[model samples]
Target: MMLPETLREIIIKSGFIKQEDFDGAVKSARELGKNLTDILIYRGLISEDVLGQLVAEYYKVPYISLSKKVITVDLLRLIPEEAATTFRILPFSKTEDTVSLAMENPLDLEAREFVKRKTGMKIDIYYVTAPDFTAALGQYKKNIQDAFTKIIEENVEKSIGKSGDAVTLGADIPVIKILDTILEYAVAERASDIHFEIMEDSYLIRFRIDGVLRDILSLPIAIHPAIVARIKILSLLKIDEHRIPQDGRFKFKIKENYIALRVSILPGFYGENIVLRILPESTRPLALEELGLIGHNLNFVKQNIRKPHGMILVTGPTGSGKTTTLYSILNILNTTEVKICTVEDPVEYGIKRVNQIQINPAAGLTFAAGLRSLLRHDPDIIMVGEIRDKETAEMAIHSSLTGHLVLSTLHTNDAASTIPRFLDMGAEGFLVASTINLVIAQRLVRKLCTSCIETYKPSEEQLSYLKNFLEDSELTHNFYRGKGCAECGNKGYKGRVGIYEVLEINESMRDLIIKRVSAEDIYKEAVAHGMIPLLRDGMDKALGGITTIEEVLRVVRE
Candidate 1:
């Protein structure tokens, strides 16, 4: 028997579907003039992704996931609409002689014959899940770009030279659906920020993934103001103001998954530049080990954070994942016995059983005021979102001095500058010395996607830089670079990990702090005390094949 027949027999015997179900499917197929596989699937007798997997394994063909894959109109045109509808197949990709089809039932022999005979080409089958197959089919039948592009073109007169059109056009394109597609696709692609910028000649849609911004699509400039208006309406920002920057937020859901996003709009030279930041909601924090803090750096954090009373500060520039590090440690430390309260400028994540408070400057709840109030709650540990000013810095340290473990973040370059920053904020040197326990400085670097990372020999200039950063005498370690692949959206990077420097305070460092030592001298002492710098961590990752040398230098060298 052929593999399809054998597979059908095996599936019938395997008990996912009964003999009666198969019989019903066959009877319905004869009466309804539909394929038996389509009948079974349409009657919800089997799962498409599962069936696709089985067929792929049996026939030794490739399986395709349409979730993150992009489909082009040109590819879809290869298969006629009638043939696709009848066979429940989608044209995924095409070559000169071989055409790849993502099918609801890859084992359908009759459908395969029709494709081969009709197109006069070799046929390749890929299994697609039921929902994905339906969505892909609908997508291929028409162009999605026309939906929004027409809306903008129609309302160009009202949209141009205005922040928002007084009259919103809800025709042809459902504003909600267009926005949903953008947000859903971004989440699926693992984008950190969704950027919409108005250029001189066009409207640009880009996604910032793995710390790099990538072009997604572009539209004519006439459509930008309307799109911006729709976003502002969704985010509840004042759409009429085109001159001033605005910050607003909204929650969006696709199916059962709901995500909270922060919206920031800045007035641009041509128009408005919008950024959407997805907040951590219903997502668990990564474990301490998963934060990429290795060796002594990891040990230093584990040791110092457990101290009953002192301050631990994580310092880095904006968007450096500082808040994420604090939340991860907070999750690890969360206990039924310990009471924890946080004062964040914008609370990003929620921990169960932890008392979290957000600082709203408009509500008389600044970071300092919030911390002062949080102390009265009698919590063992308190977290301040950021130490932006001297008052907040003084308060964070004083809270630590009163025998409370305080955790916070700051905007600084490295561990040595953490104290200098505090002192610059008008914090007393002795108070900073007594309360400070550990300072961690970090940067986020994109991790090379394992699916397509390629090994390469370093150049002479690359080797010279590595020798200065790394202590390796031979530099025999193999280096890897991302070659870009479909899985990673051709970006070569799939995710991000932190490169960190951990500075643990000792009695000698306390003296340096009290003496108001310069940042350079403080850094020398930290290096003497065996603190690993961010550059070293990046170099370690480089040698270990976790990232590339060029990527390491991208953030650290600068």
Candidate 2:
């Protein structure tokens, strides 16, 4: 019962990091009483997948990535839930006499022996990353739909017998439990938003997961008022006022982490329809690589963010991942030598050593006003959440011109149109041309579920549509799509990735901008200068099997 080489030794042998850094992580791991690998991953030193592979190489076992792996319920049932949870092991494949298991620790003989004895078969071991292992373990949890049904059936009777207004039942035990179930499950499912729709006979509960809306439950109309009231009460909104729209937010705790949920209540014919947007707890901003920027686009962002003074504008519609890109850039620029300041409508994340201001129009602290004040702070970098008007747009341009790096977002369809959008906002052509450095437009498309992604030849019509955008149709020989699986909730897609077009303002393009050319003309020049169009970028992803053609078309067309 001997383990393979120590993880620290393997990490050093693999040249993953300097020996001094590994030793420091090992010391912190010992102090925190946590796994060495966990500490490294948490601190953003190494990725889980790469570390898993490194361990598997030393342990002489196969490595598995479970992001898209689909394991059947029957196969999962072979390992008891408690044992699987305790050991971080899952059965992914099985044969007549052999069972293949993916484990976070391939050296855990206890886990291997337990699985072998339970199934009465030879066990084959495979290594899996911590994130993949945790996600796969969710397969053992009870079905969400079943849990929802059970909670409602048990509490419907209590609400059925008594009736007053929403506020009265807001405090009722039955109503509270029902509402709690929805919120709890929504958070558990990684839902971005929850929609409560009032209908003629029933109230519909829907959860928006991975950019798609799904109906979760339907309750009688009698339950609607109480549920709305409960949410309103929790969010500290005016529960009694039903005529006007109301907005508020509240923090919901799950274990040690707190989730901030924004609530919007609107008047409707049947009743008040409510929508709750679940905001994730501020954590580490993803690296640019993880956000789907690669090759030239990645290099463009990297080179420009280091410049001392210029404007970098990320253009996209709402929910298109504009803010995330801004945050990622800020994460790269965050250091002790320079001061960073930001003014946002609502500050999305709290970055250490950065000054962030949330916009309050009511208090006369708008983006324009905030930028003016941030200038006096002698900051090296400034981020404006958005440029919504001429005043804000002009102020941002002015900030960039005066020897300060500026990052901001604007609502535009593509990178080429961003220049014209500035002009439309009444920004001077010379100022826009001189101070602008880069413009990036992006959209999020559902990534094809790795476990169920299927490839096929393109149709003639699809090819024709693509040819209008792609010069070399040979790349379209085979495209991938999700075939729906239990792992992806049968949606064929599991997560989202960004598709971007980066427009680097070179001298030629900058000259055209100062001349006030049309966006179409500017777009042509950008493509000529090696800028990848959004549709082309998405198409490349589709060809690479990162996403489906339909998913790309579905998003880009909008």
Candidate 3:
């Protein structure tokens, strides 16, 4: 049954916090006039969801889970948006004349009566926990999205009509103005990606913020070429090459902040679609502390980086912040005592005393070829950007075995999978096991905005997962959410943080690896030896409200 998971469940499952600790945190929150969520999250309590869950069970009302169900326009219009807003109830569906509304305070007869008076309809209410309700309600909210949406609308008005699928741009309109308007707006909103797409009707402009996209405005079909050309000129992509896909990179300075955009143009049915990845100036290498590597994961990497001759591999999918972690390691090991050389497709950042080379196979410098040339320089350490082929893989292993510490990244699900991947690339199993030191897998999740975070209990499904995972550990249950805020542009999330799991190749691991066992078997052996998985490390951060469980799942679930 899909019943509400309560505070009692949280208390029983956590097996950590007692009634006394709760009372103390509550008292402190009251004394300091601060959010109880803040106190629980920062204090390392399990989660803030327990109290609400307890109260929710105290009242015999069914719990409602938003984002699980669809909210259609017909249902939303049953009650005036104002009445629903006033009563903190979202009327999402109907059966006959009864309207289903989601609210946390189902016991409030006055609020129910108020909603009834305003709508004059039978009210069928389901309880929504605080954070869920706030988030659901935030969708209809207009504070932050409204302001930005207005800017997009104004831009549309300058060129296209309301339903102008067949609209044409005026010749008087400056082509560069449209390009600047979209990019500046995307940057101002802190979007990580911007998409220019061609639909059956018109051109669409969308931006990816906090890992989700929001469609902002449309442009006339006539202006598509000029817009594409403008971005091509900026990225140095071939403008006239409309029949093929092309990739390029350029840095744009907006309001004194340098923004690097990785531009890709692909041919589409309507026109050439362009996608720009916004790499802000902040991609510069961060210190180990800033990379969000905590606990044993941090210490393991620190210890292995000091080793003179071994390979430390960082694994994750594309855009998973793997480069940042590698750069962090490089920064620490960089000193006058040892020479460090890096061969990257595009040098991300420049550090002092580090020789960084851009891998340009088009100019006759592939990873294998450049690495071969780099080895001739007598470097104490080498950083190959990635090991994609057998040649590069063998070369990297050779570098590690031949008394040079090699650091590189691979496209793998986790550290455990990195072993099998290297073997599949034709490296001998013993050779893979002997020279490898540490394998770190990481992902980036959107950080909750402290300025407008909402607190609530987790659902039954969420509680079940936590119980299974935290069964053997100390658990506290206080969850947080980012309610729409003007400061965070209503996305609720403000920034991103890294979650990591580290695997150190010790005697036992090397033995198992030497046997050429399955990745799953090796993974089990590693875990049995107290290797922390990426999910667990991410959960640690989630417990502190540094991130959300939903966001963590988006990364590790893959």
Index of the highest-TM-score prediction = 2
**Least well predicted 10-residue stretch by lDDT in candidate 1:** 163-172
Candidate 3 C-alpha lDDT tens digits along 1-558: 112346434554566666676667677676544455446544556543554444455576665676456576566656555566577678777778787888867877877887678667898877765545555654443333555566555654564432222212312245555666677778767688999998788888889886678887777775676677777777777666889999998888776678888888999988899899887875567888677887788888899999999999999989888888888888788888999998997776667898889988878899998899889999999999999999999999889889999999999998899999999999999999889999998888988876567667777777777676664343455677777564566777877889988999999999988988888988898889878989988887776667887888888887
Number of clashing residue pairs, candidate 1: 0
Q: What lDDT does each candidate get?
A: 0.78, 0.85, 0.76
Per-residue lDDT, model 2, residue 57, is 87
Tell me the TM-score of each prediction against the true structure.
Answer: 0.72, 0.79, 0.71
Off by over 4 Å in 1: 1-167, 170-172, 472-474
Q: Cα lDDT of model 1 overall?
A: 0.78
Candidate 2 residue pairs in clash (backbone atoms < 3 Å): none
TM-score of 2: 0.79
lDDT of 1 by residue, 457-509 (tens): 78888788778666776476557777775556667777888999999999999
> What lDDT, from 0 to 1, does candidate 2 have?
0.85
As for lDDT, the candidate ahead, 2 or 3, is 2
Ranking by lDDT: 2, 1, 3
Among these predictions, the greatest lDDT belongs to 2
Model 2 C-alpha lDDT per residue in residues 1-558, reported as the tens digit of each score: 122457557777787777787767677666534456765665557777888888788778999887777678788779876688799899999889999999878888888888878999998899987656766766754455567678888997778768777678898999988887888789867788999999998889999988889998888887787888888889888888999999888888765678888888999999899999888775579999889998899999999999999999999989998998999999899999999999997876678999999989989999999999999999999999999999999999899989999999999999999999999999999999999999999999998765455556677887787687666746445566776765577788888899999999999998999999999999999999999999989988876667887789889998
